[model samples]
Target: MSDARPAREPGRRRLVLWRHGQTSWNVERRFQGKTDIPLDETGVAQAERAARLLAGLRPTALLASPLRRAADTAQALADITGLPVRYDRDLIERDGGAWEGLTSREIRERYPAEHAAWQPPGGETSAQVAKRVGSALERALDELAPTGQLVVASHGAALRLGMSHILGLPEETWERLGGLSNCCWSVITEMRDGGWRLAEHNAGTLPEPVLSDDRPDAGT
Candidate 1:
């Protein structure tokens, strides 16, 4: 299946923000922030499958968080794309502090208001995460070839916040961009006007066309 779009003008590029596949903690509903847990068996399979499809896009550069999960996912792409993986510490998941390794229910029970606000007692703020991740992404973009694509393997929240920052979305509207599922990706294309546009969000593969004989198609 191909999700390739039309070629862009010279110097234009695309960024593929890929979230790492599921981990053991993910299955346990635990907060995995900066935990450095390796991908579970299913996650490795998911990455391999997704890499096969993403390779069709002919990505030029591969970047990932230094954490094990993200690194392993990026390595899957590297094996297929022959692109060396570059690790960026800034791409790491949000530091959940005291919340790390704790289940959602545990966090809520321990710190109700903080959990509601989605902030840990001693953790990095959303704005701080956005800044670091956005900066790292810009650096990756600088290294990309004109008209090339960069595949970024990172965490769910990190990618969402980073993409929001890169797109210049206000903090209030950031939540409008939902989180990505494991092994899913969001694509950003450089616009002609020197800005970025979200070409795809939480995309796992090319959509299969729906066919129904009874459906009407009267308009040309």
Candidate 2:
């Protein structure tokens, strides 16, 4: 398929938060944290396929976590779009600390209370992650044109938490935002009020406008 820029409304910008492809830890259900595990063979293929689809969206900027898995995934798109991929430390995954390399069941068995609270001992908290990643995203946006489309290759928890931070979702309701599957992505559009609206989540295909009662002109 021909790769061409997609049409966008004037004065609006789009951010695509894309999760990296699968790794060995992903298949084993082990915590990756900042482990820097490279992508598995399957992951390489996944990134290639995803890159093809995202290339059609014609992203203007690319950013990614410096972690190997995320960086490699971003490279796939960069190779296609010829956009330089910028690495941001703030985009790294939540530091799992003592929980790193442990499976979910193992974590619960070893640290019952911490696991119950979803807090890894000596690791970054969800709030901290949200703030760090969110700030990075805002800074990147500041450098982008109003109509530019930016694609960020990052980890699942980081992207989810960051998106929640930007969208101003309360911590209690953060879980309401589901995790993205490997190589999937979510899109957020800038609203006229300088806020953001989630247009799509955990999507593998290009976004289409959805009819909703919440539309700005719905009551007219």
C-alpha TM-score for every candidate: 0.88, 0.88
Query: Which regions of candidate 2 deviate over 4 angstroms?
Result: 1-10, 205-220
lDDT of each: 0.82, 0.84
Model 1's TM-score against the true structure: 0.88
Per residue, candidate 2 scores C-alpha lDDT tens digits across 1-220 of 9754343334688999999988888877788888888999988998999999999999999999999999999999999999999999999998989988887679879998887677889898989999999989988887878899999999988898899998999988887777777888999999987789999988985322221101112111
lDDT value for candidate 2? Answer: 0.84
**Minimal lDDT window, size 10, model 2:** 211-220
Q: Write the per-residue lDDT of candidate 1 for residues 22-54, one digit (tens) a residue.
A: 788887778888888999998899899999999
Give the CA lDDT, 0 to 100, for residue 211 in model 1. Answer: 13
Residue 49, candidate 1: alpha-carbon lDDT = 95
